[model samples]
Structure formats: structure tokens, C-alpha cells
Target: MAKLYSKKKLAEAPKMLPKQETIDFILNYSKALKVVKTSNGTYENIAN
Candidate 1:
């Protein structure tokens, strides 16, 4: 129960968006949140 979005929780979501789409979304989203991108290229709390 973290106050902010947790990466573990996001991992359980359905992958409606493909890999390429996800990558693009993560990049933009991370910038907005001012969070560093993970090695996997996914932003924290980012759902694919």
C-alpha cells in the first residue's frame, strides 16, 4: 500500500497496448511525472 502508484500493481494489468505503443507511452508519461525510467524502459506505475 504505497501512496504513489506501484510498479508491481501495474504489472498485473492487461496488455491492451503492444510493445511499441507501450514504449512510447512510458517515455511521455515518465517525463510528465518527472520519474526516472527503469532499466526495462517502463515508468513506475505505468500500465501497458
Candidate 2:
């Protein structure tokens, strides 16, 4: 969910990284865009 990645008011949020398995889950389960992390720490959306 987008809420999972949203910033909280009081505490610092934990950093999230997307792996291949996670991308697969997103593709299967949700309507969210699939994204992969690059070596330089940027995200690239996976094409459907």
C-alpha cells in the first residue's frame, strides 16, 4: 500500500528496498507499479 511507504509524523520511517520477489508480488497482488532498484540507488519501473 502507498500508506506503507508514506512518512510518519513522530518516528523515522524504515528504508524499503525492492527485490525481484517483492516486485513479483506487487505484479500479482496489487495494482501498483513494479519498481526495481539500480546499483546507484535509483528506482526503475518494470514494464508490464
Candidate 3:
């Protein structure tokens, strides 16, 4: 649940997008990636 929140936060962070078409792609793609919980209670994306 925390991981999901963090991903949502990251997706919503202030960042410049070059094109409006890419916004959905970025948010959906980021949410789709698998993340692992670290020892420090943070999350890290698992590389494909």
C-alpha cells in the first residue's frame, strides 16, 4: 500500500513533460513496474 502511494506521489511530482501524449504513458508505466521493499522500508524497482 505504501509502495503504491509512493509511486502515485512520484507520478504526481512536479516535472516538465515534453508532450501531453506522454503523460498517461509515464504514469501507467511507472505504476506497472514491480517494486521491491527494501530493508530501510523504502521501495526499489526490479529491473527487467
Scored by TM-score, the top model is 3
TM-score per model over all chains: 0.31, 0.27, 0.34
Q: Which prediction has the highest lDDT against the true structure?
A: 2
Query: Residues 3-46, candidate 1, lDDT per residue (tens digit)?
Result: 56554564566767569978997788876664457777965454
Q: How accurate is candidate 2 locally (lDDT)?
A: 0.73
Candidate 1 error regions (>4 Å): 1-18, 35-48
Model 2: per-residue Cα lDDT over 1-48, one tens digit each: 999789678987899889999898876755555666778886856455
Model 3 Cα lDDT, one tens digit per residue, 1-48 = 787666544366588657867888777778778877778786767444
Give candidate 1's whole-model lDDT: 0.66
The residue ranges of model 3 lying beyond 4 angstroms of the native Cα positions read 1-17, 37-48
Worst 10 residues of 2 by lDDT: 27-36
lDDT of 3: 0.70
Candidate 1 or 3, higher TM-score?
Answer: 3
